[model samples]
Target: MIEQFLTSYFVKNGEHLEVPPKYISDTIKQYTVAKQTARTYRNVSFLKVGQLTKTKPSQELINYKFTKNAKRKLTEDFSTIQSWIKEGWIIEEIVFAQDGRTAKAIHYRIGPSLKYYFDAQNEQQTQRLENYVLQLQKSADIQPIKELLQAVQQLNEFVAMPIEKLAHTTKLTPHWSIEKRLRFLHFSIGFFQLANEGVLFDFKEIGATLFDKIGGSKAFDRDQKEFIEELERVFSVQTIDCGLISLGKITPVFFTGELMGHLAIIDKVLFMH
Candidate 1:
């Protein structure tokens, strides 16, 4: 009967034996049997070797050592082991030994929760997750222009003031105001009443006068006509399509989309007056 019980309960495929024959024999001897029962207890020894045959022979049993802190949190029993296994603990094997008159077994294997707990506690993994979340939050804070435009449909006072101030504070030359400059010429030359009403100007006379005024013929060059044309386009009272005039001559010449009028000092005084 002892042999059958050992065979049924003590050994199975993939199961680890927990307790040596000496311990099993001692346990049976303590059962307060009759003096004649010593032989029967001794007979149970043969059953132990057969029980060992049922267990996985190649796999060795493993024992785990835990620090005091870890041991406090990992206090466990048979039910705890069963629960852990049910929750995915991988039971590699079990260790069996005999201590004095008692048979003892200690489960030894890696549990899935143990791995998960350590992974969660790892500093590197925690820092990585924190950095990822911080980056996501920073990205979320950046407002897309279209989305910003959608918010607060009408420009608020706070938004408008800075733009207005910027426009006012920006420095610009006195010459840039087109409204303050004249765009039409309606002057009479003595009694002749020459309207000379366009961007027309005599480049030869202007260049000669400029050289005489500045006392340098080198100052007057072939590009005088082109420069005058550009000056007219930039600061004169007439458009480019307007014909040219040779200041007191009657030929009424037209600039071939090239010559322009210059903004003279007299013109500036006239504008100011």
Candidate 2:
């Protein structure tokens, strides 16, 4: 699915069979795609046969192995994976030998980098989503999230607390605490936003600890990584760069009366359910 999307992205924008590298960034964001991890693909190829057009590359056969239950979903958003970019693997420049005898033109676009959380959607549709979020805030099924906030209020070691300690202290198994699978997708929006603001220093870590992917999800699901990607695409969410701030003085969040009240609204309405 992801490979197909990547292929179509260029084709849709191309006036001819081949697309220039200039369109990659905008095309990726338009589709809400994150990272393109699929290895082999016909980055740019000419079609020999087509149902509609024989000359257009739109009908080209993509050289991809479609497998069952592949992790094809666009998971990550605009990534700060500087390493991939530095190594030039994110967008590899490959040269295909012409007729397997001489060098031909090179293809420089094959992968993606960023996709927005909610991009180019109609206002009414987005409003409906916002209303759904409001509904979730008041939902009764959010006991676990509410309970986690209460636990954090009492525990000074909330962010840095060990998962085992949290489970023991809360009288719940780590397994029980995990929001089942894709729930992490819709669920962590506020948390990611807060994390982006550097308010939830341990938000990502605590999230990972809670949902460690035990025995795979019962249904098709996405993990914290996917959730983070989706959230970051919409909002500028990222971890605290330790170099920017002093880590030695990193103390726990003091949960006092006013603080608890503030956290209650944030944790309950923003993060829960």
Candidate 3:
């Protein structure tokens, strides 16, 4: 039945059937026989007649020998093989080849049949399966941009405060010594220098024109202390010098605080170090 089905379905078309090319060659050898006989010529010259005959094998003739052999080697192997073939777990195709001395031979293309089974399956089903797998892979890949975006939004809101009111509300505390103030100012300047370009600073030269407006380090320290105190009072935030000032949270209005001015803290010394 299988051979008949293959013959009818694959052989009718001029195009070779989808069988293994080797199978086609083997089939041609198995089913074709050549007979040679002496023939008499009219001129009394001897001639040899070579006749090639083609025959179709019966279902029993084409029965799979491996099935029986496999069953003998391992019990139930034949049944398993039959089941796989019937369920489209194996597939076969017809192929053709030309010979220099004789007519072309027919071969079969054979392989595991799952591909043929799916050949008849719905395209949309296949696409859905592929898309599902892709989605699974995409989900497995992680991203960190969301948290960064949220942080940026929060920071933007904090830097939107009005400057004048912020400065007025801030006041220096006794705990904030001049030395601490000077250090904070120095650190702030450094942070700004790293964050931006075109900034002028002269930390080594005391008499440099850079500090002329602020009257050098002493005046700069005093101003910074007052400014920070006023900034804290107006923004309702505490300033800690853990290398970088950490104002836990601030409203957008606090950005415009009088002493702090409009500033966005990007990469701080704390994070960089």
Top candidate on TM-score is 2
- Kindly report which residue pairs in candidate 2 clash with one another: 34-76, 117-233, 117-234
| TM-scores, one per candidate | 0.18, 0.18, 0.18
What's the residue-level lDDT of 135 in candidate 3? Answer: 39
Please write out the lDDT profile of model 2 over residues 149-262, one tens digit for every residue. Answer: 432232223223343343344322235332331243334433432333433344334334334575322222334455445434433333343111321233554444532223
So what's the TM-score on candidate 3? 0.18
Position 241, candidate 2: lDDT: 34
Estimate candidate 3's alpha-carbon lDDT, on a 0 to 1 scale. 0.32
The lDDT per prediction is: 0.30, 0.32, 0.32
Q: What tens digits encode model 1's per-residue C-alpha lDDT throughout 1-273?
A: 333333343344433323333333322211111111333321111121211111221121113432112222234665554444443332222232322233343333333334334445555655754454343333233222442332222222212233224224222123322211111100101001111222344434433432345533233343444444443443332322333344333354454665555645673342211
TM-score of 2: 0.18
Residue 78 shift from truth in candidate 1, angstroms: 3.7
